[model samples]
Target chain A: MQPGEQRDEVEMLSLMLLIRRFEERASQQYQAQKIGGFCHLYIGQEAVVTGALAAVRDDDYVITAYRDHAYALARGTSADACMAELFGKETGCSRGLGGSMHFFDRKNHMYGGHAIVGAHVPLAVGMAFAIKYRGEDRVTLCFFGDGAINQGSFHEALNLAALYKLPIVFICENNLFAMGTSVKRSTSLKQIVDRAEGYDIPGEIVDGMNFREVRDKVAEIVDSIRKEAHPAFLEVRTYRYRGHSMSDPASYRTKQELEKYRLDDPITRLRAQLTREGKLTNEQFDMLDKRAKETVLAAVKFAEKSPEMPVEQVYDYVYFNGAKE
Target chain B: MREITYRQALNEALAEELERDPNVFLMGEEVAEYHGAYKVSQGLLERFGPRRIIDTPISENGFAGLGIGAAMVGLRPIIEFMTFSLSLVAFDQVVNNAPNMFLMSGGQFNVPITFRGPNGPAHQLAATHSHATENFYASVPGLKVCAPATPSDAKGLLKTAVRDDNPVLVLEAELLYSSKGMVEPPDEELLIPLGKADVKREGTDVSIICYAQTVPLALKVAAQLEEENISAEIVDLRSIKPLDEQTVFDSVAKTHRVVIVEQDHPFCGVGAEICYRIQKNIFDALDAQILRVSQEDVPMPYNERLEKAVLPNADKLVTAVKQVCYA
Candidate 1:
């Protein structure tokens, strides 16, 4: 591997590790009643975001559904800010008003972690439209799950984006389940990409489990999307190691299936490949893993030190224009 | 400079905006080939092509949410609901998503989009179709709400709404589409500033605050009262959300007695807000209690007679003004 590529992989692996450890701690906190409201983890789908985000530009916009903590962190949100948001702290990303489902950092151009299913898709399209209208060269990466593809907003937005040739990339994280029902029961089209034909946009299916492949394919499409100034759809086929959220027992899938996915764990494979190619030393990998865990621990410490959100702050940040006091 | 119907003024405003800004586009159900349900978008598809002036599906939530999203990235989208009642289907998208996006994202993006459509009850439209939600929509903080009464206001307000950095809701009156008046020929682009009320007619006896369709009814009542030597000032509340309380207060201060006329039911309506503001700002100026002339508090009936019986008419304003004057 090239030295620069090796360095990039290390950085990506570090992010994946930080996200995994952060979520594991978050799940524990939820069970212990330390964290409140709903909590969805990206323990399994870390590679999909780590790889996809690596291919995009910082100026480019990104939007996603409620299952969005991963994308927010990958897009440049601090570990402490995300943890504080999950803990509902005053210093959180949304100032603790939005909780886990609505993590947002405008400074990073990361549109909030939306709660509505398939709702943020059109906003992504609109963002792209704005780019095209202004005659700017920027592509938007909108991440959504298989569940959102069935929503009317998804279809209408896709059709409109195609019709207008908006610069948007629709990334479908097809983890095969919508809350509890499998994709088969929820949709007639086995392949989510099939819906793209109806909108006249190009579509592709990718192995979301492989980080390098996901990154290579995303970079290929995202680069062209910037040059072409048109939108494309990507269906990243992957699995979720955890349940839908903290409250779910994950009764939909079996332990064997989970174990089968473990064989292709993006983090494990990437780390092993780096070690085998002599791109990384065992001691170096161990230190990097330890540092990622320490970072997560430090974030937890920071979140724990923060004060709880005041009840009255609930009504704040409702309007950015400051129309309401 | 050119005399045109309210519908024509709106069409002129849209066509003019499209020509000026490549970023501004119009989209909604039947906004293109079908020429809009109200035909306000007629001939736009031919002028701007299918891409810029497009038609969408009947999914209100979907398209409304799309407009919000589209606005965030940089495009200015103009969405149309057939009427205010149909806007309820996308209430979550408008009230929750679009308005909250900027603040929630900590100013990451601003939705420069407009949701325009006919608002309030029309002849024979029942509960399912007839609704005046100016008050409901105005309550939301991030959005700007405007109800244009004249052909000039329609053209001016729509031009301003298209360029606003925040989301705007333009509520058009279905009955006033055919009303004719000369529009200020899309001369220099002017905003006509939001929350400002226009005194359509000046008087000293009593003040009648109305907007949209009711503005004309109040004007007619004022003209009829002229024969009786009772000068009634008609205040047109062009923008309801950022209400022009000063204009209403100034008129109320002079008139002493005041009456509010609205097509919507008075219960928790825009009329109530006008009454509340009048009492709050000019309590000493009033000679008596403020009277509200509004549609009867019930779903609009389809029968022409029943519809006439409930909706605010010149007769109702005449009676309401006399009551306020006598009190």
Candidate 2:
């Protein structure tokens, strides 16, 4: 398919599969202590990031929570920097200042993988506010988990964004749980989108596990947001296959329940659909799978070879000042 | 040059900045409609309209985080907390996000935002509403903290802060808002250098070091002591983060006596840093022990008498100066 072609279903499928395989490999590495400190994997929720990211332009800003490897990869952070960041090496996106929870690429307009639950939401609002205030037509895509919706900053940002009519697309990936607690246990309102009505902004629920659904919904809303210069909210209902971090013993949810949700694995479902529609051959699928494996391996190798930041470099990037220390 | 209240100078600076730069705007509770609770934003809504001068909900953390986020995208936002006391609700945004964003983003973003408004004890507003946040904010590396004492410094420092490339905390004195001083009208292009001290008064007997409201009190005390044949030099530390200790120490070295006055409680106050640096650098130069006159170590009281007693007022400052000079 031509790169300019209106996002081919096969390409969407390939992107989802790539994110899945990359995360699977990272999960293993994290378990082995190769990827240290607060690793939140996006295993079951690949479709939301993959689909939503595909719908937006490169100029649009994308920021999300700590469960952000998939979102970062989808937004064009190189596999090399992504894996290196997970390794806490100097070559990482944040120069090893932010390990897994704070991935950032300013040039690419990917703001952060902010660790604080609802902190980045306001940042997204501010970025969109800047775009509108400057008379520029740009959108800021802010993604957060279900738990973030309950935070005071989230409501405050949403209210300000709504009041100013800032161009922003707020994507809430409601993956059932925040760390260990379920959304139902945490929030009185089961559907997080219901909270948006309090701000007088439009809100909708998307089957986050479905690539086409997320892509179509996001594309429709993003296009309108660009035209209207206002904010929109989308709650992508999804799930996570692994524990909150790397050290969990799979105690949050039952294996049977996990297996039930795994039936709709975004990557497998997309791959099967692409083959059925003749958009991709089994051989092409195999080649893509092989390419993904090689890419992950190369990233691991690059990170392994990368030098650790010197003791002096520990405080180097603490401030942007020109001093080495 | 015009003589205006410190509040008016800040208002003028904000209005001029908004007109000069399209990227500059103001956000805070009662900033737009109520013409600013303290009237610092008076007539701004009528002048710049609703788009630039925004009134926010009583949500400091939200608006503060919004200001940080907006700054990251190249918009210079001036976020006002009605008082420094309310800013504790937004402390995480100030310390965590505002400072960490630039470094965490690998220089891809700059938080060119100013979180300003009156800081320090204000009348009998009680414990929750009275606070000195210079030390709290200065402890963070990615931030630039300024506590301007005079109307001129407030206007100049605010203008510089708005145009700075980093997140700046402008600690305005609530009491100084009504104080009149000579201020040059807004020079949008002019930038006052940060991290410098202003020698408000020159003397040879002892050095009275302070900033914000305490500087004025120190200066008044210096004047009263002048009749007693004692001279006191006054150093108003304009910025706290990149502390201007040289100017302070130079005075101390010349005078051989030092007295530090601050509006905050003595424990871990902004004066503590000045004392530490003074002891470390000019221990032998001091003829008398460095004396610090600060607020009493108690939650700011609501009663006027208690509030006055708790704060470092002219009386406390004068007493400290006399002790330092006679010791």
Candidate 3:
């Protein structure tokens, strides 16, 4: 194995670990009532974002659905800001205006953490449109879950993206169940990639349980997208260990099914790969895990210490032209 | 100043703004090759080319959200709905995503998009096509609604909507598109700022509060009231949101009576808001119970006669004004 590949693999492994630790802490905080409002943990689906974000350029645009904390962290948003955002503190990424669902960092090119299912897909198309209009080489990485594909907006977005040949990669992370209903009940198609046949766009299915696999496939797809300014659909098959949100107990899934998926967790798969490749030692793995825990603990402290947004500034940002609400 | 149709004034406003800013673009269903369904964007394709003048499919929600996304990244997008009635399908994008983007992202993003098209009941167009959506958009906190009554205001207000940093909706009337009115040339840079009411006709007896298509209706009623010696003032609320409350209150204080005219339903319409604002602020000045001349609270009928009866017209305005004037 090349030295650089080993280094990248380690970086991705550490990132997935950080995200995992951050979410576990978030779940604890939400239970404690410190972090309120529909917190969706990105526990088992770390590699999907960790890898896709790794493949894209820094200036390339990225947008996703509400399950967005992992994407934000992977895109270089500080864990403190992400945690504070969940806590709805002024120090949060959205200045506390957007709770756990809406994380926006303009300088990082992270467009937003849009909550509405399938609504932001067209926004991604428009971002790609703007890039094409400006004659730029930027490609947009749009992420959503299995639930969003049923929306008409998603199909419309895909049609427009294909029509204009916009540089965008529609990444669908099909983590088994969309809230309660599984794909067997909701989606009619046998495979999610088949949906792309209507638009005549190229589609691929990737195993999202391994960081290396996701990173390599996305890098290939993004390279073609950047050069040709065409669109591609990628369905990443992964699983979520936790419930849909803090409130959901996930009663639909049996204990055996949950346990079965947990064994194939993305974090474990990446760690095993690194260890097998002789790139990670036992002490180093333990050290990395401790460091991730420490980082998350520090973030929680930061979020706890951060002040709440003042009431006087409630009307702020209602309009960019300074008109009162 | 030359007399031009409201459609031509809007066309000129779009042309001028597109010429001024390279980032500005127009996108809608028939805006490009079709030259706009109502021909409001006629000849724009030849001038601006297909790059800036884009034509989308019949996907209002998709394209509306696309415009908001483009606006989020510094592009000024003028999204045209063939009619405001069709914009109901793109309600989430219009009322939620576009307006709330600025605030939701903690001010990290600004959606400088304008959703413009012919709005309100016109001719014999049935219920689905005829929607006075001023109240719907004006009620949104981040959206600024413009109802230009004349060609000059159409051009000026549209140019301002394009130039403004916020999301502005220029609500034009399909009937008024063909009507001719004086409009200053583009070289004059006519920009009527939002939240300023234009007193269409000044009188001391009664203030006829109105906007958009109702502005013309109120003016005609004022002319009819002139023959009866019941002088009526016309206050055209050009901007619905961030409404010209100062001008409305001043007009109410001076006239001591108000007859509001709106193309929308009576309940919770712009006229209803105006009534509440007037009575809440200038209650003592009111000589009578503030009257409203609004469209009947029912779906528009397809028949021409029934449509006219359902809409706010000179007759409704005259009657409301007479009651306010005690004549």
True contacts kept of 1: 0.58
lDDT tens digits, residue span B1-327, model 3: 888999999999999999999999999999999999999999999999999999999999899988988998889999999999999999988988898888888888988999999999988889999999998888898999989999999998999999888899999988899999987766888899988998988999998888899888888878888999988889999989879999989998999999889888888899889899888888999999899888899999999989888888887778877877778
lDDT of 1 by residue, B19-84 (tens): 998878898899999999999999999999987887887878767887887777567889999887
TM, every model: 0.88, 0.96, 0.98
**How well docked is model 1, in DockQ terms?**
0.43
Ranking by TM-score: 3, 2, 1
Candidate 2, chain A: TM-score against the reference? 0.95
Best by lDDT: 3
Q: Residue B253 of candidate 3: its Cα lDDT? A: 91
Give me the candidate number with maximum DockQ.
3
Give every collision pair in model 2.
none
Candidate 3 lands at a TM-score of 0.98
Model 1 chain B lDDT-worst window of ten: B101-110
Model 1: lDDT to the true structure: 0.84
User: Over the stretch A115-199, how does candidate 3's per-residue lDDT look in tens digits?
Assistant: 9989999999999899999999988999999999999989989999999889889999999888999988999999998888889
Estimate every model's Cα lDDT from 0 to 1. Answer: 0.84, 0.85, 0.90
What is residue A38's positional error in candidate 1, in angstroms? Answer: 3.1
